[model samples]
Target: MARARICKPCLWTALLGIGFLFIWYFKVLALGYYWLSTTVNAAQWEGSSLWLPGYQVAVEARPIEGLTRNTSGLTFNNETGTLFTVINRPPQIAELTTDGRLLRVIELEGARDPEGITYVQGDTYVISDEHSDSMYWVRIGPDTRHVSIAARSSLGIRIDSVHNSSFEGVSWDSEQNRLFVVKEKLPLRVLVIKGLDVFSESRGFNIDISEWKSSSAASLFMSDLSSLTLHEPTGHLLLLSDESALVVEYAPDGQPIGMLPLWRGFNGLQRKVPQPEGLAVGPDSALYVLSEPNLFYRFERIQKPAVAAN
Candidate 1:
């Protein structure tokens, strides 16, 4: 009878706590952050910055040919003027035109859950395996139909990584020769790697990795990180969130500056991009986004000075 008295109170408290967390995670907190972050950044946004508010979707939810599922992280190959994305289900690297057309599929051998891929100058690229927390440097030539990584060309960072929440995206800064990586969730993280000479013939390693911490990131409003792309011109970083259905842009100094929401009716999107997994910027500065199960979208700059709030 003494224990039964506390049980009812404890159960009520537990139920209340669970309800609050669910609301916070799924809706309330995200809405609050979106309003607050975008409002604050809009005041400080510069015209010269990579203002994502000026973009509107040109092509929305176009299905990529031959891809049934798992069209993941994206990167623009400036050398070839094409885009590349990974499919972890079958472990393949697919080349694509700037539009939603598939060019070729390069088989990726020995990749474990390859979720993120970035072009690193020439025909070289880096692929991040979410399950393994590892990155492999591989080459893709014109005649190449397959890529197999050697043990020496791979680097792993296994620091308290969980299975699906690790290594979601990567982008290379050609000007600085540095690589930036983003984790999916569970304390979302962005790590920068430098001094990694992927083309160096020397087997010895000389790399320094550090976390890219921001005041905004510490209070990151996104439900989860999905992919990221670095705009080479302004050196700004764009972080994509699938659950939030948004892309938050940060200045080089790590200040949140602008956002591009992938929500329907906003950004001129006819339909909401379902599960955005890949993000890239083309040579002409058009934004390219890829969603899972093979949906491709392109957003071009409109003359809008205000964000498309939904």
Candidate 2:
């Protein structure tokens, strides 16, 4: 008997069907990989605690020292009374004396465009890549400084993906034991991560960002919000924006109370503060603001002109 032969139409149809199946299989695989990566990153993020609406306060501008251009976030050490500011482009954290002097510069590792800086338990916490969500913790010691990789999840917050969440401002509430983070713009809101102490104990915490809820009170500065700091003594929240020449103060309930314009000149000195990014309140109730390209301002509360002494 002659060997059976496949028909031409059947052969062509079989080949086409196989090709289509292969294409569909690869397409699904590619999508699955992309989704897996996203899920993994999201699983790594941790959420924050203590959500509150924020408002703005008026600030008087006095000059200070040590901050270079691109200073982003600011935090005050109630224990030491020192102000911490993070310089992005160059990725340097500077400690300033309340008197407007540059005291020390803490060099950071793997800090790609750091924007927020806060001090927790004597260690410096820095948030990097405002456009891309990533965080780092640099421990500054009296003898030697050490750098470590930190995950938002470590603090019980989840990050859905590295590309989804970009954190611009960060502040630690020692009293409440929480970390507050702010996104740059509209839907402009702050996130509170709880169980910070638990993560600090573990030294490696991962939080899911999907669980984070936006603060009903916090609003972005007119342009880009560079940083935010909490006033320990007063429970006030301060917000800074580079585009707007102003710093705002908000209450815990997110009610705007006052506004501070960057003073052009004061004390008979001509001061130009361009791109004010970082803000910190000192123990003496003085406000410290840092601008890009290297400039610091100290605003001392002057008792509202003493009511002209009656």
Highest lDDT against the true fold, candidate: 1
* Alpha-carbon shift of residue 300 in model 1 (angstroms): 0.5
lDDT tens per residue, model 2, 260-294: 55545432225445677677765555566766655
* TM-score to native of every candidate shown: 0.89, 0.63
Candidate 2 error regions (>4 Å): 1-68, 124-132, 145-165, 198-221, 263-272, 304-310
Please list the Cα RMSD from the true structure of every candidate, rounded to 1 decimal place. 4.0, 15.6
Model 1 — TM-score against the truth? 0.89
Position 219, candidate 2: lDDT: 35
The worst-scoring run of ten residues by lDDT in candidate 2 lies at 46-55
Error of 2 at 11 (Å): 54
Return the lDDT, model 1, position 254: 82
